[model samples]
Target: MTTQTQTAVIDQLSKHRTVRFFKDEPVSDDVVHTILNAARQSPTSSNRQTYSIMVVRNPETKKKLAVLAGNQKHVETCPVFFAFCADLSRLDVACEMHGEKHVKGLESTLVSTVDAALVGMSVNTAVESLGMGAVMIGGMRNHPKQVAELLGFPNGVYVVFGMCIGWPEWDKVPNVKPRLDESVIIHHEQYNTSSPVPQIEAYNQTMADYYGKERNLHESAWSGPLANQLKSPRRENLRSELESLGFVFK
Candidate 1:
């Protein structure tokens, strides 16, 4: 008997790559509507649907956003930029409509954030399936408050992350990035508590081969740079800033 081939969705997911450069082309409103409609079907927690997307197309706004995102030019150049926000403001109003008090706590924060992430992933998948390219910008959290003010966001809403989508400049596109091996990331049934050092070392060499040809880097690709980055706190003020935006951690 012949083995069945993997599904189309699996094939598409396996070839995922981050496209940081894009061609000077526009994504039409019809396409945006179609993608959003599909992405809105992504599952949400308790049907709360506690997320919002800020679709930015204006060059001036994109320019400011690019600066706020640590000079990520893709934010400015991509035909469309999506700021996926964890939004509790709608829920706050819903509570008020029923004469109930809206509670702000860690549970709500996590739900909204996760909801935003799920929708963003859906959007990315849809974009790629349609032959466009995209990249997620995590630097949106770098200056959360400033981003909020710039985008005129109400209280109880903050950008969880941003996405850039457009026709890719194929010539400038890089190879698919390698991920940690399944042995390191996946466990059978229960969590595996063994040392992952061996797997990591092997993956590092694999990355070295890939990066050496692409980026001319021969250093340990996985662990060494990660260790240096984790040595110091990143976005140390993120907690305080999110608190100021009405998110509760307790």
Candidate 2:
């Protein structure tokens, strides 16, 4: 998909609305295993691999997760679901098995979180490469405690986020969304603030147009949405919940 193999890799990235359906097709377990294997093979900090992935196949679990995600039906309908977790309890057990006490704190927690996110992204890469449809569900953090309870999470483990995986609807393949200029995002050896505001505004305009056509709905651009975040209630109590679950985030 590009001039070279390296650029070809970048060219395959999904942007904007991407895919949401697959004309009655379903992803097979073999393919799912391959994708998960690729993700497991991803590099980890200190090779700890302090993250775990939980696949949800139960209809009831999907239904509950949909409710937790604010009634996002795509979450329920997707053929497969995966909950990526930042797991500290795994390490705790390993340490205890070696006759050592749990010495992990914020640093260990941070590593696990990073490991989970990186592996999640890696799984996405592997799945998308196989022509399977996928979407990330960061909304799992909206009700972290509720999700954890529902999933029967242990004292040292919690869900960082979840994903909806499936085949794309033939008619629902989405176009590439607009992105900010390379100049605005890519800085050299140091940060430069010559002026990204104007570029951001321009990028917002492009995104607005994309949203309008992609969903056939009228939507506001970047600046308006940027201002609206102030009025929103952020449910990212995941850190505090993690602490309650026995994780030491410092």
TM-score winner among the candidates? 1
TM-score of 2: 0.90
Model 1: how far residue 229 lies from native, Å: 0.7
Name the regions of candidate 1 deviating beyond 4 angstroms: 1-5
Model 1 misses residue 91 by how many Å?
Answer: 0.2
Q: Give the poorly placed runs of model 2, Cα more than 4 Å off.
A: 1-8, 14-17, 216-218, 231-233
Task: Itemize residue pairs with steric clashes in candidate 2.
Answer: 21-168, 21-169, 22-168, 22-169
Q: What is the TM-score (0 to 1) of candidate 1?
A: 0.97
Q: Give TM-scores for every candidate, taking all chains together and pairing residue i with residue i.
A: 0.97, 0.90
Top lDDT prediction, candidate number = 1
Looking at model 1, how many pairs of residues clash? 0
| Global lDDT of each candidate | 0.94, 0.80
